[model samples]
Target: MHPLAKYAIGFVVLCFLLFLLAPFAIVPSGMRGVVTTFGKVDPVPLGEGIHLIMPLANRVVRIDVRVQKAETEGDAASRDLQQVVTKIALNYHLDPAHVSTVYQRIGEDVENRLIDPAVSEVFKSVTARYTAEELITKREEVREQISRALVARLTPYGILVDQFSITNFRFSAAFNQAIEAKVTAEQNKLKAERDLQRIQVEAEQKIASAKAEAESLRLQKQEVTAELLKLRAVENQRLAIEKWDGRLPTVSGGATPLISINPQQ
Candidate 1:
């Protein structure tokens, strides 16, 4: 009946009303609210905005259904027994329709509980199938394989794989050094082969030139010999005619020398 007591009672009622209305939850954009009644999850999920449920009996768990990125790094072995250090990144999101199931089954730590382990396991398995060289040369293939495997493994758990990538791959220092040495050796071998071919070509050209020069000289020598023989023959004929006399003369000096007797006057 007192004014103060009435005001006090009114204040208590106001507080109780506020407490009762506290069960109404606002699911923000890009999120889904999972309702659990008496620890049992409801099949239907609550979408974004205000949601009302039984006060003190139902709980709403909000889950982000937007795309998220996760990165992980681990060591794996190649098919050739080479140690490979790999880092991978993934984009994923919770399936909005399965939000309740996802929360109930795996809770809110989807990155650690599901996606991260999946990345490591899939990467190791896929890496084990390829050699270290293949892992580098066929990076796109490796990425596709990882993405496919991740989708297959995580899809059943209400996690959708949006995209996956192999960010980095590294080998041991000794192995890297060996690769460099091998490449250098191959290049040197190729250069040597080219040099040898060039030398062979040059030698052939020189031999051909020498043959040509020798042939030219031989022709010139034959021409000179024929000309000299013709000249000598002509000179011999001329001397014989000049020495012949009109009359025969006496022989002299025990030799066949012909002498002219001044025409015998």
Candidate 2:
């Protein structure tokens, strides 16, 4: 071989060695390298250490099997025929045992086709059971029911739902206004009833006071009548003596007492 050709051949060999060694040089922590040979995945996962594979035709795909989050927002109609915007936050992780199935069916970007639709379906199905008011007031119940539904639905798809939260809810403008008006009217009715009850109590107290005063006056009038009767009797006796004429008849030791009264004398 010519001298220049020999040097070129040596450089090409060095470059091939560098490419094979470079991929295995750095394996980050918390990452596993999956080695595929001839388009077939090996059973064992490569750990955080150097690994060697064929410089040509073999490759390592890093799969991060840690827990991940999938947040989704969707709108559904409530039983009351109102539209509501709902936010869903889901905590999920890959089933390491089912990694092969996950790769086969939906691949790493499975959240879009699988998880996203599953979440939307659960929200729509669950919201159909409740009105918008119930959803707002009993949020925890809705959240628990949705979580269970999501876990059951996604489990078979190689996705494990850890937990979920129903983050926010919003209703349409017209429905919200109607609800506020209803609440306000109910409060006003309750306040009016309370005021009427208070007035009735006060009227009862005044009636009791009037009855007591009237009874006291009746007793006082009875007492004044008894004293007036005694005075009237004494006044009649004095009038009879003063009106007697100056004529007298005598009896054995007593003079006739005047029994009639003459006012002319």
Candidate 3:
């Protein structure tokens, strides 16, 4: 080979090696790298884009320094001594400023080593303060307490606890059946009570109406005296005589007529 051609080939090979080594020098966006020179960690963190480091003596540990989520599922004990399976999901992120401390103390397995324990502890502690009934009814309060505790415990470990949710809880099958039965019985009782109230209300209305009618009759009796009674009887007799549909009765001796007519008519 020609000397110039050999030199050119060597240059190309060097460029190819540099290209392969460039990944150690550069990091993707929204990422931070820790420089570990011969397994010795540097306190200063590496920023995004190209960086200069020892090709063979140094390496970079890339970490996603952004918000992330860690969800966990487990069983917890309720205040009522009930074993309930629960799902706890947490929104968390690594603190870019404390990446070194995080890596050093909790390491890359922070979710399992640190966050998991903290989540379990918080859930157990908070749930212990509430009964099974309250766990269902006042769930928001319990969740808030757990969230606060988790935040306080995880913040020191460079894990910012953003939000947490208690997704599901399963109670004993017997307890669930009992609850349903109790609710059904309550509904039936309410319906019966409402019906009884309606009947009583109707009875009261009828009694009032009867009393009103009795009072009216008493007033009519008072208005009708002996003279009014005689006049009413005479008027009824006149109508009956006028409505007679039979032959006239013959007078024997001097019998007075039942109805007298005016001579002018």
RMSD of each: 9.1, 10.3, 3.4
Candidate 1 to truth, TM: 0.73
What tens digits encode model 3's per-residue C-alpha lDDT throughout 1-265? Answer: 9999999999999999987776447778877887887888787778888888888888888888877788877567887887767889999888887777788676778788988878887888888888777888998998899898988888887788777898977788987887799889999999999999999999999999999999999999999899999999999999998998866777789775787668998
Task: Show model 3 residue runs off by greater than 4 Å.
Answer: 1-3, 20-24, 237-247, 250-265
Instruction: Please provide, for model 1 over 1-265, each residue's C-alpha lDDT reduced to its tens digit, 9 standing for 90 to 100.
Output: 9999999999999999978768588899999999998899998999999987888788999999999999999689999999999778898999999999999999989999888888899989999999999998899998899889989999999999888877789999999999999899999999999999999999999999999999999998888876798898899989987998865666667776655567768
User: Best to worst by lDDT, what's the order?
Assistant: 1, 3, 2
The residue pairs found clashing in candidate 2 are none
lDDT preference between candidates 2 and 3, better one: 3
The local distance difference test score of model 3 is 0.84
lDDT: worst 10-residue window of model 2: 19-28
Look at candidate 3 and give me any clashing residue pairs: none
Runs of candidate 2 exceeding 4 Å displacement? 1-18, 21-27, 52-57, 211-265
Clashes of 3: 0
TM-score of model number 2: 0.70
lDDT of each: 0.91, 0.82, 0.84
TM for every model, in the order presented, reads: 0.73, 0.70, 0.83
Q: TM-score rank, highest first? A: 3, 1, 2
